[model samples]
Target: MRTALNLRLFLAAVIATAVALVATAVVLNFLFRLYFEDRLRDELETYLIQLSGNVAVTDSGEVEVGPLADPRFNNPLSGYYWQIEVAGADPVLSPSFWGAPMALERPEQPGVIRVQDINIGTEEPLAVAHWVILTGQDAAQRSLHLAVALDRTDLDVSVAGFRLNSTLWLAVLGAFLLIASAVQIRLGLRPLEKVRSEVNRVSRSPAGRLSDDYPTEVLPLVEEVNQLLDTNAATLERVRAGAGNLAHGLKTPLTILHGVERKLRKAGQDLLADELQTEIASIEHIVERELARHRDSGQSRQVCEVAPVVRRLSDALSQQPGSEQIRWSVEVDERLRAPFDEFDLTELVGNLLDNAMKWTDGRIVVRGALSGTVASLTVCDDGPGLSDAGHEIVLGRGRKADPERSGTGLGLSIADEMAQAHGCALTLDRSDMGGLSVMLAWEQAEAAPR
Candidate 1:
């Protein structure tokens, strides 16, 4: 199967955009988590400073702490706590711990806060910020350790919320990007589509060429295509000219051979003359077939009314010597058209009519009709019809139903070649008139004017 450029480009864009958005979401979530954790540690440090300021050492080496302002420190297992420790004295703890003391170590430097994560007998961990300070006068001074801790679950909840919201918004953004990418791809490929249309126009036109109204990126392609078309037209012209010249060159010799054959027959050399005549007829058939092929190849596709061509050929053929006794019938609509050059259509119809005139006992029929976009032309006669096998045999070059018939045996072959050249189908079948029926059908290029 052929891959479409639009589909391939859209798929690539979809993959790239999806990958980029996922990476963005991951990175943003990671960075946000770190920032949220940092902010949480700063808040814990602030609480630690408040707790240290509330601590004091007694003259008898006893530790004392004032009630902290935050209510979470007073509630049992509230995931928030404060503790104060003095050397040679019992530590003062926040009621929020519920008698579960945290094994926090003292900070190395006094008055410097240090933060760490520790499990607090709960499903989530705690973020602890601790500091050491000196309390009391010089002789009575005591090193006191102050600490404030908050549950890690709070940070987890905040980060989780941010991640959810960010993902939702980012997904929406990715959707927009995908739609925009699809539109961009379609717009970007429009010029190529136009080029294809112009090429089709050229094929259907006699002297058509591609236009210069294209993007700079596609201009070179357009120029190359135009050059190729010019080269092809030139090549076909040369081929037709050569074929015509060769035909003219051989005509005189064939004519001379005919004269020689007649003289040999008059001299009673019947066998030798007959062989020469056969050779000459074979050469003539080859020349005629090649000429017809060359002519059909050079012609451009066109929409020509089928009725007029059939009528004209029928009128001319009906006036021939043998067609006088035959009853002619033409059933064709005036609007019926086929995708074929007028010259080629004339030659094709002429061959069928001429062949019918040769074999018809008394009646011949020609039909032309348009059904939807397809147009058909059929010529039938009332004569001895061939069997199904003979239908295929007569379509071959130099093949005829009767060898004794005075013809080059190329009429049906040439007609079939013309039909195929225009992408048409030509078939032979048993006619209702008791003879061969040759039908040519092709898709019409455009509707003919009423």
Candidate 2:
């Protein structure tokens, strides 16, 4: 499914943050439990030492345990206890002793002790004993020792209270962090949101463009897009203005010619009337060609495929009159696609070829070849070539190079404008066919070539 860019970015940040937090919590929780358990073990081991110090052998050889001095150690219900004993007699238990004297299988060995949910009387479900035997003493006189059981019912209760309180506090912190993450995501993405809102108001119709000032990160993109829109708008506006101006400017002369033709018809001079009609038709043709010039002024410089346009033009030209009589050739690599519209590029090449065909009395050769950074086109005609003045006037507005040099006077001008729009130029010179060889030298950028 398609998602908003900002939303996806926000969600990705949230997920990554959450994963990091969970990983940290797990690691820290394990460490806390490990350290806390160690502390509890150390406290139990310290109690074992305190109890041992109170034990002594009497003169009659009976061992006696003195009353524990610490108030907490004396309380049976406090969940802590100890046992003192000398070998061979019933083990001495504290008055607080609430369990059976231990029957340890390993005889009070020292190290890790494992005992589970053993009952210690008074309805206690949890009790544990840490027993150790003092070595290097006589067999009859060795101290059989123990660090007595914790009520653990109370220890468990304390553990439950501690874990509950810690969890509640951690939950509150986690909630705050989640809310903060949402706010942070919204705050971080504000600039891009502003860009979207700005773009929403722009339109291509009235040549509208984006104008919002984005953050430094997005500013370049916004600026480039706006520039492209502006360039396209300017080009389209120029074409519209040029069309309006050309229509108004060329119509006046045609109107005058029409009036002159009417005058000649009313005067009834039949011989001269035919000549005037032909001249008027010729002028009308020129006016149409000038309109073509204005129409061809727009060149769209988006990604355009050159091969398709060439193929389309080749097909179109084949259908034209006397198309088979001339040798037509098109050469382009598969990657040499035109950057202009298929129709626009086609119209440019087609017009140039049509003009060449008109002037070529014999063989006409048209070919487009590319070499590295430059693409060149040659439309050679075995017909009368252009004179010195033809070069200047061909590119000038509405003026023919040679008044006597044939065809609708606007063809050369249309050809020149098309060439410039397509990023090429027309050069007038002699052909090997003893006619005009118009060499078009176009430099295609390593970037998109129009």
Candidate 3:
């Protein structure tokens, strides 16, 4: 499964802590068991020494037993026991054994100590043995073996309690360590979160750049990003300068062609003069359209207020020769702004409004509104509208819906280009004013109305 860096690190640390704690608990429990076994052997050795000091053998081979200091040795099957055996006599057993005998092993040689684990009937016990030689009356010698043993219950209980407590504490300690690791991971990655937010703001703001307030490890990356943005800005400026130079260079040839047309008319070649005039007009239209696009690219980006641009274009179109006979009206929110440069907005509105003034018979209306982050502009006229197919053809460059209309086909095409430059949708439909309606819709860049 996929996992984030912080979560993966946390899980790794927690698993490692859990495994280490578990291993520590196991090792400590094992060591405690070994220590407890050694303690049982030591206690058995002390009992062995006590029994040997008080034991005796008579000349007639009778075994004599004595009282021991520990009261546990006197109680039958009290989990404590002792036994003594001579060369060929019956074995002596502690009172703790009751009538049951312990199967304690003898030492191989005199004064040699032996330790083992054996079962007294069904119970397991630790057994330690010592061998010696005893002298009786007349200098006769007899062999003696002494041993002590106890059950494993007390040792088991002690080791079990130590393991339980150690595990509990270690587990609690592991939990705290995991929590600390989580906190450390969060603190370490906080700077990265800040960088992500700043990068988003840069994309949304035209003049925004990455901030330098970052850790040493991240500072180099931030500097590189800022450099890239600066380089891009310089490249766009050079491109715009080149386009402007080319446009001015072409205008000179167009001016010379106009002079030739006038000279041809003065030479009495009227037919050739008219043809050159039409060609010059066509070339001028192409130049104007290209210049409009160039301006769109060169203009500085800003929030273009819709109301002022619409009113200014409406007033300018009203002054045109044919437009004086028609009424012009504009309705737009004063606070509404589009995410476009001012010159681009002017070109888009001027082209559409100019076309409306040329076609409308009585009245022309321009309306604008803001809906959420989207802005919509509509221009309508009371003249005859186009069919669906005709509207489609009008959107194409150099294609006029009605050739009889006294205008070049560049108007609607230029407006369409501007809409596409701003990443907008331009569509045509019949208006309620019993005429053609053109609408433009685009997303706004600003958060507020202004």
Candidate 3, superposed: residue stretches over 4 Å from native: 1-3, 31-68, 85-91, 98-145, 250-383, 403-426, 436-450
The candidate scoring highest on lDDT is 1
Residue 5 shift from truth in candidate 2, angstroms = 3.0
| Model 1 poorest ten-residue lDDT run | 296-305
For each candidate in turn, the TM-score is 0.87, 0.49, 0.69
> What is candidate 3's local distance difference test score?
0.78
lDDT of each: 0.84, 0.63, 0.78
Lowest-scoring 10 consecutive residues by lDDT in candidate 3?
Answer: 295-304
Error of 2 at 67 (Å): 1.8
Best candidate per TM-score, number?
1
Collision count of model 3: 1
| lDDT per residue as tens, model 1, 209-265 | 999999999999999999988997898779879988999999899889989988999
Which residue segments of model 1 deviate by more than 4 Å?
69-71, 75-78, 136-139, 298-304, 318-327, 333-339, 370-375, 383-393, 399-405, 420-423, 442-450
TM-score between model 1 and native: 0.87
RMSD of each: 3.1, 15.8, 5.8
